[model samples]
Target: MPRFLREYFNRNGVGLGSVMLGLVLFWTIGLIILPQLSMLDFSFRPNLPPPEIGGPKDLYTLENYKYLIFGPEGGSQDYNAVDLKVFYRTLIAAVLVTLFNLMLCYPIAYYLAQTNGNHIRILALMLIIPYWINEILRAFALRIIFGESGVLNNLLVGAGVFDTPFDFIRNDIALYAGLGYAYILLMIFPIYNVIESLDRNQIEAARDMGASWTRIHRRVVIPYAKPGISSGCTMVFMLSAGALAAPQILGGPSSLWFTQLIYQQFNDNSDWPQGAAYAVVLLVTCILLVLALMRVFKVNMGDIGK
Candidate 1:
């Protein structure tokens, strides 16, 4: 064999070596190179009908991006005001849902990690059982419970909590509830994995020193589990930001999400250029958030993954 091949096989056995090398090449070409080229190509394409003989003649125009990001004030066609509103609302909702999930999941994850016996088993089951059901089914089940004539409103009315059924569908509360339910497992798992790998001796020592539960949790546990928290928050935020089904079925007409707008642009309106632009914007936002979190928490991505 050649010197490089001999060294490569020495470092990595031939079978595993070829697979790893292929994967790296595949990722580099397909993910990094192709997508960047496609994004650059699509971003400058026109919103109008395609040319007959050539690819876009105006390949450097900013009209598609400008129209999508900011509404066209002087366009002949009807502008998408609803799209803009949905985009902002989705951004805000995702942030709120991520915060809510972090608050709710962290404590439970900590308990699951620290506790033992039946309690741990029960908590593990609680986290895992929901995954057995399809996500869309879960959303639909929530709809059945929260719908106008659903069990919740019926029971509320029966108990005289309210004279009539409250409008739960298409409301912000429903959106938040649906989002929280869908992402709760995702939030818990990362934190649980991180906390499980933590050294318990330090926490025991803190307690032995007569530290209060709150003080120990604040000073020791949180700092140690920061990687897990960062991973969980990043996963939940990204998923919630792109969520379409739960928000669509539960959020109703008024509660249109940004993903819905993107879907409409791509599928309903056949506006691929605008959809790509929206996707690019969402991608940029997610990248910025990941970078910001890495900076703020000083947690390496490798540690979180581990």
Candidate 2:
């Protein structure tokens, strides 16, 4: 067992620790790893009818993967421009959501973590109360808020800020906003948890050394919050990238999400291998991005566990 597990066992004793350990193993292996392995296997295999699943006709091939590039039958084109465009756009949108949440939440996290006040509880409640609702409900609520005649636009128009309601949904504003909002908590709490652990004396010492607020944060706060930052970024990015509901609910006519394509392969097209292939592509890309972010943050998996 790892040190954490050993420590956990010591604290909880054999019986309770064994139950927790079993649950963790079951969730990790039975739920996550097995499904992923199944999908990966399906991705490599050709789509076949139920009777032909294990028949001689059912041989593994790269056709499903190639289908993403060239369609069902290989065409003599460089690539499928539309699908690839959507794929790249989805990635960009996910990144934007991650960055948006980070920028918006970091200041709030700092305030909540560092400030001392009787109002902190109320402020924290105000921040958190909204997220008590389901993610889908929140997305729909955002749709209502950002629609042309919706709450925000209506408020602006009634206040004479605009002569007419803005086309936020049609303009793709709602999609981005909803994506960012959906994952905001993921960014905020991780940052808060890490920043809360930082010693106040270090910050005070830096201030006494005549460090400006910006310089103090740059040299002291952000560096200390690296592990939390990494965890938040990773969770936000992965969830944003894999999001289906937000995109489906708030997407504009031009806003085609990559997951929609994967959904279509499984449902509309009924091509399991093709769907698995698209899913595998997305999964691999997300893993690569996580690795890249970890590298950029100079954070190891062990640090993120902290």
Candidate 3:
């Protein structure tokens, strides 16, 4: 048996451990893997009318994925520039959101993990209270705040910060803000969980050894928190990139997210194969990102699993 399996059985006893592992296996295969496999299979098949699903026309092909580059029109265009641009922008925004949350959450996570009193409770309550509301509602609330006649614009005008309301919506500012806020907790909790287990004596020793705060965090804290940090990055990037409601509520005229394109393929175009292909592309990209992060941080699957 694997060492982790051995540890699990030792900790939980064989019966409970077996049950736990079995449940996990069932959930992974049933909920996650099976759905992905279905989608993958669908992605390779041609889009056909309901009656033609199992007919001779419903053959497997790479034409669906090819449309991502050549487009639905296909054959004439140099490339599907519009969809490619949206995909690029979405990825860039996701990366920015991940970095933004990482920076914003690290200090708070550090404070929460290290603090030893009622302060932790108070801080945690403050963070959790806002998130208790539905995510869509939270996004709509931001849309309200950033609207032309919104509170932020009114306050800015009143304070003479700007002569007119800034176009936060059209400028994609609201989308960025919404995505960042939506995934902040994902970043915070992971870092906090890992950092909380770190020995304070190591920090004290670093301080005693005359390591500056920046050096201490760079050399000690961040290294130790790699697993959590990697996990948080993975979650934030994937969630932000795949977000539907937040993008819809907060995106402006010019903000074209890649997920919206996939949504359009499915709903508006009614092209299931095309949509599945797009989803597969996105899923593959996210998986590649996970692999890259693991490589960059020297983090193994075992570390994240822990």
Candidate 4:
């Protein structure tokens, strides 16, 4: 058997490995590498007309990115500045949402993982249930519940809480609420998975040493679950940062999210080069944030799954 395997490897291994390597290279080059180069290429030559299907190449310039990062003078349209603002706002919103999720999810995950009962299962199921619905449908439903004439306001008005309906959509509050609702389940599952695998004896030992609940959590539980918390937060932040539909439907006119700006460039304005540049900026920012979190937490990415 060993001799046969050795012979097969000597003949076919190199060929099979090369084929697999080529396939991977093809996808990497086409999807990620080449597109990034193209974005950089296009960003330099913003105002020039796109090349014909098979026509002369346009000269490269830095006007597009410059216009994006800085406003045009003489009241020229500064879509670039607008795009940059959206990018910054999106990053800030995502970070805040991630922090909120981390604070809320940690205790819940810890409790759920430590406890065992039908009630716990039911609660977990309830949290998981919302994710089963389409995200757009969920966001729309939230909008209805929070809209001026929505049920909450109607109830408040009926109770003489206020004479007029309250505005709940298109504001920063609504945006955060929408993002929180959409991604809370994602935040919970990972933390719960990690906490559930923890050694019960270690917790018990902490308690035996006369440690308070807060102390035990701070010293033992949290340290043990750090990987899970890091993983969950990173996942939620990345998802929320790129989220468009929820913010759009629930955020209203006042809350102009960054993803909307990207969409406008690609779809509304038909400025694919500018849109690609914005996307690249967003991608790089997210990568940096993840790296920062990993460094600060001293988290080994491989431990997230465990």
lDDT of each: 0.83, 0.89, 0.92, 0.82
lDDT of 4 at 2: 79
Instruction: Specify the poorest-scoring 10-residue window by lDDT in model 3.
Output: 69-78
lDDT per residue (tens digit) for residues 1-306 in model 3: 889879989999999989988999999999999999999998999989999899999889999898888776635678988888899889988999999989999999999999899978999999999988999999999999999999999999999999999989999999999999999899999999999999999999999999999999999999999888988888899999999998899999877899999999999999988999999999899789779978977899887755
C-alpha TM-score for every candidate? 0.88, 0.92, 0.92, 0.83
Give the runs in model 2 whose Cα sits over 4 Å from its true position. Answer: 1-14, 74-76
In order, how many clashes per candidate?
0, 0, 0, 4
- The residue-by-residue lDDT of candidate 4 on 1-306, one tens digit each, is 478756755776868956875788899998879988987776665444555523555556565566567756455664556666767878988999999988988999999999989999899989988888998999888888888888888998999988887777745666788898888877888899989999999999999999999999999999988888888998899999989888888887856887887788789988877777777678788989898879888988786665
Local accuracy of candidate 2 as per-residue lDDT tens digits, 1-306: 799979999999999989998999999999999999999999999888899889998888998888778754646677878888898888988888888889998898999899989898899888789989998998999999999889999899999999989999888889999988888888989999999988999999999999999998999999999888888988998998899999999999777789998999999989988899999999899999889878876899997777
Rank by lDDT, descending? 3, 2, 1, 4
Residue 201 of model 2 has an lDDT of 93
Weakest 10 consecutive residues of candidate 1 by summed lDDT: 50-59
Winning candidate number (lDDT): 3
**lDDT of model 4, residue 116:** 82
lDDT of 3 at 18: 91
Clashing pairs in 3: none
| RMSD in order of candidates | 3.2, 2.3, 2.4, 4.4
